[model samples]
Every structure is written in structure tokens, then in C-alpha cells.
Target: MGMDVYVGPLTRYTLGDWLTVVQQTMQAAGREVRIVHAEPEPEDVITDPVAVSDAVRSWQAGLLSALGSPEGWTDEAELPYWTDKPDWDGYGGMILLAAYDEQPEFRPGTRRGLLRRESRADSARAFQDAPAYKRASSNPTKYPTLLSGVEWWLPVEVAPTVFEAPRVTGQPARMGRVDQLVVELTLLAKRLGLDDDQLGQLRQAGPPDSSTDVEAAGRFGLAVFLELAHAAQLANQPLLLDY
Candidate 1:
């Protein structure tokens, strides 16, 4: 029942933190990995699926182009940070792979090997192929985190996500399951000073993938959603209203 998974509200956490946890999890598992934002785009919060896809594609392209060519594809001295340029607001996090997980290598000009091979094309093409890029993260949960207290194992399923067959290696990570996560989150709420509603709000918003199959969605949905909500709460800090 345990299906290992990466957690996040892509916007909620820093790129470093997000990537760290993700790398750790996948490294423990010794498998190819992927992370999809609960909210692929800010607009995904609305019911506009079309707009969401378009936005995600744009971001996807810009990201690859930048990573593939850190000093600017066309040889510009300064390159745009992944945050603002290309309006990083679209999509959750990125679809990353742990190419050589042993030590989280920093190969020159090689950042995201996890992205679907096709998404690596020019930014425009990545956007146009939104559906495919979106699917890249749709993988059956192999290792999900334990929520806190649940006793039984719940298979981790992240549907409409990108996946690759896991290559079990040294110190392989145990899989994360939904049932176990339910228990963990119950405890997480108390530890983090979050009530059920806070957790519920987090749980409610999940990755935008209506086209995914039923099985994966049902399993890993809540775990992934909680991560997003947590991140969103951090990234979108509420403003005080002056009376």
C-alpha cells in the first residue's frame, strides 16, 4: 500500500528546499522521480483548464531553455532566474529526475533531466505539448511519506503524472502509502499548529489533471494536495485588511 511520493506546494517552498526533499526521497528510493504542482498554474485555481495548459507550456519551455543553456541560449551574459522570467507563476514545481542520485551532481548546464524528453524542445514546443508535459509527472506512487499516525499502508498513486520504472539501488527508500500518510498528517496538523480546516484547505487543492485515470488520483491525491496547500499558504501570505 505504501507508494513513495514527493511533497509540495511548488510556490510555497523555496527551490532549494523543494529540490532537497525531492532529491532525498528519490535518492532513498533510487528511482527516477517527478514532482507535479498541486496547482499547475495560478489560473488552475479557476475552472479554466485551457488557460492552465497554455500557461504551463510557456513556463516549461523557458525553464528548459534556461537550464539547457545557463548563460542564455543565445549567449547573453546574464540569464533569467527560473522564478520571474517566463512568468514562473504557471504550473506547480517542475518535473525533475535524479539522473545520478548518489550525490546530487551539478553537471554544468545540465539541470532538469527528469523532464519528458519531448518537453526539452524549445519553450514554445513544450507549452504546445502541455498535455504531454503534464502527463510526465503522472506516475503511480512508488514511495509516499507517512502522514503521521495511520496504522495501515495505503498505496501511493499519482495519476496523470510522469513515471519511470524504478531502479532499486543501495539504501533504497521504502515506499510511501496513502493510508500511512493519513495518520501522519493527522499528527502533522498538531505539530504544525494547523487545524483540520487548514489541512483540509490544503487537501482540497490538488494537481490539475482531470484526464488522469481514477486509480492513481484516488490514492496519492490527498498527500500531494496537502503539500501544495502548505506551500501556497507560505507563498501567498494573506494581507491584513485595514478596518
Candidate 2:
């Protein structure tokens, strides 16, 4: 019912194996860690380093092929992963992005009348009043980077043709670089009174306020997205906005 953001390998096999490696590595380092795979694997299959390495290689190759052999795409050497299922639904996500598009200086409390608890009619009116770029349309160019995709955001370097590639589910996906996403999110965090250090600390913080107040929802959604973007940057992984 809400967005489930994941920062990790794009392919199922790669993700499962990568998680296996993470679990083993952490356990070996005297830390208790357990990782649940996004994709379920057979209980009989044993995932080892060799399997993980092969899976990663195959994932990289498939991505290269899908992107038509784009130059300068490097395979990452490290895996830093993160995932979170925020409480905001798809509409909430769109509204938050649209709000940001309209007002980049969005704060927790502002009399801009952009954030308020609303009835169903009021909500629909708010959506209608959003900037033209954020509305649903067949013209892709009308959408901003954050609102372009309903489901996926690839970690590949920004390229004009990258947005044209099909998602793993065979649907159209969005293209964005990790650095670009991080920049946008960092700005939003600063508007909320969080600096780089405080923003990074959000990874360990509890969930944001869940009141029906639109401003609160927007802040919580932004925190979730910012955290995911940071994770994607660190892991050199795609950002999957799973519904």
C-alpha cells in the first residue's frame, strides 16, 4: 500500500547472494546480523562467495547490455545496503514531490497553505492545484526527476537514453545518478533544519510523525527517500521504489 525503497543489487540472484555474503561477513566479525532477501530463494540452494561473485558479474553484464553498452559504467567493489517501508502511500509520495516542486523551501511549519489536513475533496483539489509538471501525463518530459518514475530509479550515470530502458518488470523506469539524488535530498534536509551530520543520523532515528498533517507526512517521506538515496550512493546500487 506504500512505497518500499531498496538500495542493493538489481537482480534477484545477485541480491540474495549479496545478502548471504553480508550475513556471513557480519557474523564472522563478531556481530549478530540477519538479512532477509527481497526475493525468495530456494532453501536447498547454498549461496557462497563464488555464487555471489558470479551473480554480480551477470547483473553488471545485463545492465550494460540493457543500456546499449554505455561507456564509463564501472562495476562497484563494495555493497552497502538499506531498505525501508515508509507509511506514506503512493498518493502521499506524489503529493510530497509535487509540493517540493512547487516549494523547494518547504519547512515543517509554514503558512504557505501547502500542507494541511484535508478531506477527500480537499485532497483531490490539492492534487489538481499542483504544478502541471507533477500531474499524470503521457508526456514524460513534464515530470521532474523525483516524480518521473512510479517504481524504479537506476544508479547508472545520468544519460539521456538511460531513462528509456525497461525496468526488471518490463515497465518503463526512471534514470538518475546517485549523486544527483543525493544533492536534491540534501537540500530538502537542510530546509528541515538538518545538516549533513544530522541527515546521516536519520538512518538510526525512529519513524517520523505519522499524523494526518500533510507537512508531517511530507517530512517523513522525505527522510525515507533521503536515507535511501544516501544508501544508494554508498552502495553504488539502484534505488527500487517498490509498491
Local distance difference test scores for all models = 0.28, 0.52
For every candidate structure, what is the RMSD over all alpha carbons to the true structure, in angstroms? 22.5, 7.0
Q: 240 in model 2: Cα distance from truth in Å?
A: 0.7
Model 1 lDDT at residue 119 = 23
lDDT tens digits by residue: candidate 2, 66-100: 66546423333354556665544323644454454
- Where in model 2 is the C-alpha error above 4 Å? 13-80, 89-143, 197-205, 208-210
- lDDT for model 1 comes to 0.28
Top model by lDDT, which number? 2
Say what the RMSD of model 1 is. 22.5
Worst 10 residues of 1 by lDDT: 81-90
lDDT string, candidate 1, 197-241, tens digits: 654553355433434332223222333434533432333321100
- Each candidate structure's TM-score, on Cα atoms with residue i matched to residue i, is 0.20, 0.57
